[model samples]
Target: MNPQALSPRAKRRRRLQQRQTVIYGLLIAGLAVAAAFAYLVFSGTVPSPWTRPITMPEKIETSETMECPPEGAYSVAFGSVKANVFNSSNQQGIAVSVAGTLREYGVTVAEVGNWPKFLRTDGQLQAGKAGIVAAYTLQQVFPTMQVMIDDREDASVDVILGHTYGEQSLIKSGDFPAGVEIVPPAECVPEEEPTEDELNDGGEDLVPEDEETEAPSDGEEDAEA
Candidate 1:
């Protein structure tokens, strides 16, 4: 018997099988599409820092360190509160951005100066102090920047951010964008108030009483006699 001339029942069964195959394929394709849609919706609707690709940190870590005077530097610490930011030197100590928007991400070092072994804690870079090494890219938002402390108080912070065009003696080139500036901390001293005596003396002459009297005593001697 010719295969093309199959029995009616055989042809009908073959058609049913083909229809079932197409239906199953369509079902599988639909399921894949739905899964992809669900993933995008969940990941997009939820706000997360991980959403933005951290390209620099993912590639390699870059860093640099410098010694700077707290004065002429930007304030990283205002009173008891510290701005957000951190830094590291070698395997010890972490630095911080003294005063700026970046302060929101400053570092708090549990260790004194051992950066690699230091511990960083803050709400911004919750990745821990280890994120210092991970911050390989410095995007410039300020025309000038500085990291400074309020006093000689130790644990003032390990690093500061500022521009160098001023009297700043330090310059951080690598790991920083070209022409990126590092400003020194500004002076933080309470304004001096004039004392009561000082205020009263403002317009007064400083002539001695004896000098003001001139030679009156010598002339008065004759009147008394």
Candidate 2:
């Protein structure tokens, strides 16, 4: 194994083999590094370099507006005003009867029952600030009833019938504003009964076939001849 004892071709072959071994080692190391990088990508261990940014829309706020009548100017329809009729009197069925009458006059009656123990009156119309116009309209109907402002928070009026609420006839033509007139109940007309012929029809064909026709009588035959 002396350096000068080897042939030139053999030395050249030995050097080529060493170079090939180094090349194979480098290729194996590169493959191992590539496999490690692929594993990290699949397992989501590191954030991907290619990603997109997301944006969201902003929220908006809005307000609602309504036109109201001028101060002291009462303009409203009877049907738009919600009323509660309570029987304050000891007599029975007054609340129901009065509530029906009010409904006939196009008033929107929300509740009907006995009055609360604390309030007492012959007939009183109670309302809040929002129901002032409605209360005034009802006052025109019950002239003797008192209109009072209370803690009621909605656009509704409370009518408590008192001892003298015997006024059953609400047919009087009051000067109610347009679209607030008294709307009477529609007349119900009963359907006419079916006749005996209609009953015998039985909703089926009744004519005889030509092949099953009967012979004519002597007088009918002479007329035909």
Per-residue accuracy of model 1 over 1-225 as CA lDDT, tens digit each: 685999889989989999999999999999999787778778786354356643211112222222233223222222222223333323212232223323333323332211232323211111212221122112122223322222232232333221222223223322332322333224322224676678668676566566775555644665475
Candidate 2, pairs of clashing residues: 122-162
Candidate 2 Cα outliers beyond 4 Å, as residue runs:
1-71, 118-120, 168-172, 178-225
lDDT of 2 by residue, 87-153 (tens): 7778899789878878988899877877654334467677665775677677667766665665556
Using all chains and alpha carbons, the TM-scores for the candidates as numbered come to: 0.20, 0.44
The superposed Cα distance between candidate 1 and the true structure at residue 80, in angstroms, equals: 61
TM-score of 2: 0.44
lDDT for every model? 0.35, 0.65
